[model samples]
Target chain A: MVLQILFIAIALAGVALFSYNLKKVIRNIRIGKAANRTDQPQKRMMTMVKVALGQTKMFFRPIPAFLHLIVYAGFVIINIEVLEIMIDGIFGTHRVFGGLGALYNFLIASFEILALGVWLGCAIFLVRRNIIKLKRFSGVEMTSWPRSDANYILITEILLMTAFLLMNAADAKLQAMGAAHYTAVGSFPVSQFLMNLLPNTEGALIAIERGCWWFHIIGIFGFLNYLPYSKHFHIMFAFPNTYFSNLEPKGEFSNMQSVTNEVKAMLDTSFTPPEPDGSKFGAKDVNDLTWVNLMNAYTCTECGRCTSVCPANITGKLLSPRKIMMDTRDRLEEVGKNIDKTGNGFDDGKSLIDTYISREEIWACTSCNACTQACPINIDPLAIITELRRYAVMEESQAPASINTMLGNIENNGAPWKYSPADRLNWAKES
Target chain B: MSEQLNFEVPTMAELLAKGEEPEILFWVGCAGSYDERAQKTTRDICKILHHVGMKYAVLGTEESCTGDPAKRAGNEFLFQMQAMTNIEVLNAYNIKKIVTGCPHCFNTIKNEYPGLGGTYEVIHHTQLIQDLINDGKLKAEGGESFKGKKITYHDPCYLGRGNGVYEAPRKALEVLDAQLVEMKRCKSNGLCCGAGGAQMFKEPEKGNKDINIERIEEALETQPEVIAASCPFCMTMLRDGVKLKDQDQNVQVLDIAEITARANGL
Candidate 1:
């Protein structure tokens, strides 16, 4: 009864803390401008299934994709066994689903094999990050916190998988000894190898099984709470992020309606522009960005796939797409905290442009869609870069000298160069 | 070098004045209008249209910039102003079908103009050439036979990744008698020519090397005698890179329309 009470309390606390943090994340994302991503529900559902569920884009790198598939599959399939553990934990019962006899044996045996796979997959990932030190994992933006966060997640999964196998091994030993409540129902295909490591005595065996059961459940709860704070938040945000994908041609940027209204008024004197709402011309900070853009920033997994394929980053430019996302999320979090301490009217003098992302970094982008195409989830970093550019040009009226010259040409002359509109047909006269 | 070939290219105003409307309008972008190298490509495109006996007319002096660079440079007001003016001219002519030599203009007119109450059936020049080949109106025979020569096509960003029109350009090239090679980064994964997003108007940001040089190195790896390009921006960048490497004598950068015109005896 005491064990059951302790299990119930821990489970409830875990879920409560996770829900609280999730609410804060949703609130922070909602702090941005409104965007209508709810159109075309069927198409959005298809995208979510293909990109997030199917993991189709991950196959671009075959080896890592295969390893990630194993870990992802194991995490999902092994969690089914967690359902049974939860039932047993709540009722103070031992292997409550073991009544199915042969079927239960098959299920437990499959889980043990998957647990083993998860162990090996996570071990290799650790070596790839720490020992081999892959270039993609060690960018300038990947400071100590991100590196340690990745290592912590991997190590925790490895430890949890270890506890799972040992728990099964001890339970198997207890079943053979005909100990009370230790039903001899499960088949140990992979965990049988660990039997030699466990003691043969019934009391020692019971303690090991209970200890592992507690450890695995508590570890999962702890991992759930850690997700929102780490890059692992992608595990939760990838689905919604992909579902809200920009379905237009990748080159087509969003038209600014505010600019349109003003331009229409300027071109046609009879045209009546709407009353000014005092909205800024473009995104100077997170509040100016669309909600979908904020969600995209949170969904970034920091894999550097976008940065790896970027032309600007490839040519040693200061711009890194992964860093852009990290900065957005960091700034959003800072904004969120300010709102929490002071009411919604809080202002922190710092904005996302000069304080976080530099003009040089945003300007270096080629507006090429490589970053958008390379994302496993359809995170559009180019969209945010263009938004920042719009703010710089339209609001601040500050652009590179040559760009200003080009804009001047387009304004005075009909072309980007110092040519007359009458000269447009000159190409036809040339032989 | 050859006999003089005389042909008349009509403008929409002249065609409309004659109580006639063209089947399609040719959108000769800024580069196609003023840039010396791109003008040659513009003439070849005109030559191909004349050879095929297709009724086409240009907007002439009435046409303005497509505001692609302005919009991309983050000046939405300038972009919309330019777009509204062009949209007014295109609507006045009641142009239904259009083709462009530059991918930037094609993409903007096809994709962006619709939001501002201007919609037309826009296509890149390569797509039109592909249609011409498929309909047997244009053929790569009885002209410059590139039978043994090797050629590689550089996919323009605004055409390939910007819009999904990879097969059209390649199909136009496939009609030629030359061998078509591919760079390591081609199709949807194509590298930018360093002149996109208003980069053509300004010098590139501080970097170890320019983007065009990186793309040029990948194209040179295929060892093709001719690097076929479709967009004028890409042509200028590739030509500059070839000159930098002193491979201009060895590598001849030509537009797809230019090559097709030569192959078809236009």
Candidate 2:
């Protein structure tokens, strides 16, 4: 019955991984199309490979990068151990190729080494996120963490990996008494020394080894299936998302979606902007934003580089580009839960200025490209901002009275100043 | 706004009847036309123009805002319209060469307007002064005019970051025998004067700290007596900031044009 259950569990885990990865791939395809990536296909592909395989931008802090590198390496190589466990669990055998086989013993030993490495890296990651105030983790307006999900995710990974390591140490003692020289299990000095205290030796040690293997396999599978619902979703999202990053030049504007006849029918006949009592032309909520932009709010790593370099934020203005991404993130998570239940998000279509972001925030941007440039991830807050401005100016006619007055004068006078066009070269003539 | 400051520049009739590469079309700019003190530099530059025997033309009451303010304030329509008019005026004159005292006008004509098809060979007057000094057409008169005063330059966006022209103004000041102090942020990262986007022509925004105010404070940190600048807008904003911050008790805002021209004794 135990063997039967193990096979069923392993089969279920494989199906879950396949399904989740496929869904993630589909979403990435949509994002790549939406960004209108027209750059050289080869260059983008090369960048994706380097960033994905290398975690290049992850090294902004070398410590985190170094720590993550060990775990990442272990995660890739330890797949052999997982496959061995799955085979052993399904067939009720200690080793499919026999414990005497060199390859099988090597893999078992390799996984123990990796488990130790992963434990060390995960402990540092937990400490860095928790005990230290990195400025990246400090929530604005609140002293405590605003989003607890990543914190919880980290804690859970730490607990599970630590327990898995303990399980390995326990197994190493049990395995060393047996004939198989599972490199780590047989060679570990402390475990080998500990194994001598047991009198019943052979039979009892084999039973202990078998039980520990089951625990290790189950813990790993549980973590794998739980990943899509956790903050570790970045593992799946980051690579493709990096590849599909907004390829539009820093200077070019994202073109407005052409209002189709279908969209016209969706609107009221008056063409007046949606009021508090009516649906807005702007996003009344998160659903109104472009889908990939909505994805960005969730995918944000919450690095404060955008806030640090914002021209508006620097000039003592209230607009924090980091906060802008955070705000959308908070809203989407809130509304996303509701959408799953009731099929609703931003139904009112109110402008972003009116509903989500304030008008004072909208006018504060210097269009300096500093915020977009500073962001480690390719989240273009400025592009989203200017798109909102384009809608307000051209479609909704909701630009601030001050900015519009300048626009009006320029529209009328050919210069923001009240000078005559014929006198353009007046300064050039020496009087 | 001061209508009394207009001047009569002797137009070079001979330069207009020229080959493709003429010597110079001295762009006096609105500030030079209106500010009485700025005229000192205007006259000195004109003398430099005359010294080279370079036939130079003037646009006499034909110059206006280069729409630098318009583009800065997100007023693209006004900027483009000005571009077209400027192109028409230049085409009519058959003018091929240019020099200007206004960095705003220099940036607009050379960078912004050309992108809209009003391309011209534009240079700031300080640049031309530096070039003339190099060619021995202009003299490096040191002691008397500068009077051992320390100077710090406020780089206007239109001149510095807008076009990456940093060296000429510093060279002009150095040659004219003034000490140069670097502001905390200068050149590419130079702060705005609370005035780039037509803000120079208008009242201040409700910023927690005015941009010009912040910039002036950084310049004051250098403890220079004179805040020398190359652009009219920077002159206006930095001067206002100095006054607002009460640093005018120790500092004075002067243009490179005024400084170089006074030192040159033109």
Candidate 3:
């Protein structure tokens, strides 16, 4: 009873801290301005099923996709065993689902096998990152904490999976010895071999079992809380981020409502022109971006797949879609930290543009939609790039001289050229 | 170059003055209106229309740019101004169906114009050519110059990935009776011509290689006798890329309209 109460208290505290951090992340994302993504609930749900649940886009590259599938399936299937552990911890029961007899054994055996698969998957991923040296994993922005964070997550998963098997192995040994409070009800298909390594004494068995149990559960709680600060948050946010993804044609640009209303007023001859809205034309900071854009930033996996297929990035341009997403998320974290330290509306001198993302990167994009299409989770880095470029031209008036000349020509000649509209048909004459 | 072309192109104003509404409005985009090389495509499309006996009229001096470059360059104010003027002109003519030889104009008129209250049935000239061939109105008979030639089609980003019209161009190419070759990257996975998003108006940023050069190298890998494209922007980019390799005399870069016009002995 005492052990059960202790476990309950520790679990409650961990969950409380996790909930607090999650709420803070949500609040920070909601700090972005509102945009209507609720118009197509049915289409959004289909997109979530296809991209997130089905893992449809991941299959574009086969080997990593297969390995990721094992990791993903293990992550999902092993959580069923976690539920039973939670119940056993709270109720002071030995293998609480042990009453189901054969069904219980089958579930335990499957969880043990999946735990092994998870361990192997993490081990291979670590090797791929460290030894094989894939080009996508190494980039200018992937240094320091981003690099170490990935390594840490994989190592942590390997450790937790090992701890799970150790606990099951120790328990199986204790059950075979006919010890007090030990249940021989569950099956251990994968961990059965580890029983020989465990000492054949009650004290040793209890200590190993208890230590692995605590470490496994505590490690899970720590990973849960660490997610919001890490790029691994894609495990939770990919579904919702892809669900709210833009469903319009890739080539079509969204017309700004302010620009539309102004144009409408101009077309209306009877109505006089109104004063321009004081609002900035495009995004100058995090607050100007929509909530979905903020969600995209949070859901980035930092895999660099988008950057790999990007024509601009492939041709050695400064523009990297992965870096664009990382900058947005980093700026969002900074803004969130600023608001947390000071009161609600604190001014951070740093803006997303010029400080984190340079104008050179923004102008380098060809808006080819390759990055958007290549993203496994449907995060539209192009959308953010376009908005930032809009700010650079409309708000800062810092476009390149060539672009400025093009814009000037459009404003003067109804075309992007020095020739007048009267000369448009000059080429139509016999040539 | 040996193809004989004959066509009497009428203006929209002339047709409207005669109390007639043509079946389609030919939106000769800025390139078709003023560019020397692109003007040949415009003439080829007109010749094809005459061969098929389809009544189509050009907007002539009344037409202006669709403002694709300005809009892509992030000049929304100028784009909207130009779009509104063109929409007013189009709505005045009561244009029901439109066709263009340029992908940029087709995309703007089909996708962007609807937002500005100028809705019309927009079709690319390649798609129209495909339909005409399918309807038995035009035929690629014995005079097919490209028959059995190794011809590969370069999918323009605007037509293929941006708009999902990949099959129409391929089907049009199938009419030439040529052995249609494909680059390693085609269709939805097609690379950009490095000219979209207003990149044509400015020089590319510091890079190891030009995107057009990379893309043209992929086309060259197929060892095609002719590299075909349907966009004026793509035509220019690939032509320059072919020239950079000094293969202009050996390998030809021609638009679909030019090929179709010659195949029909226009």
lDDT of 1 by residue, A1-431 (tens): 99899999999999999999999999999988988889999999999999999999999889889888888888988888999999999998888888999999999998988888889999999999999998889777899998998999999999999999999999898888899887688999999999999888888998999899899999999999999999999988999999998888998888888888999999899999998778787889998889999999999989999998889889988999999999999999999988888965237789999999999998898898999999999999998999999999999999999999999999999799999887888877765
lDDT tens readout by residue for model 1, B1-266: 12233777899999999999999999999999999999888888888898899999999899899999999999999999999999999999999999998999999999999999899999999999999999999989768887768999999999999998899888878887689999988988899998888889988889899999999999999999999999999999999999998899999999999888888777
lDDT tens digits, residues A341-404, model 3?
Answer: 8964337678999898998888888888888888889999888888888788887888999999
**lDDT of the candidates, in the order given:** 0.91, 0.60, 0.87
Docking class of 1: medium
Q: How far is B160's C-alpha from truth in model 2 (Å)? A: 8.5
- lDDT digits (tens) for residues B3-101 of candidate 3: 334446889999999999999999999888777788889888988898788998999889988988888877777788889899999999999999998
Clashing pairs in 1: none
DockQ ranking of the models: 1, 3, 2
Clashing residue pairs in candidate 3, if any? B4-B266
Docking class of 2: incorrect
Model 3 spans with C-alpha error above 4 angstroms: A272-277, A344-346, B1-5
Candidate 3 displacement at residue B211 in angstroms: 1.1
Candidate 1 interface CA RMSD, Å = 1.4
**Which regions in candidate 1 have their CA more than 4 angstroms from the true location?**
A344-346, B1-5
Which candidate tops DockQ?
1
Identify the runs in model 2 with alpha carbons over 4 angstroms from their true place. Answer: A1-35, A42-136, A139-146, A160-164, A179-299, A314-316, A329-351, A422-431, B1-208, B211-243, B248-266
- Where does candidate 3 chain B have its weakest 10-residue lDDT segment? B1-10
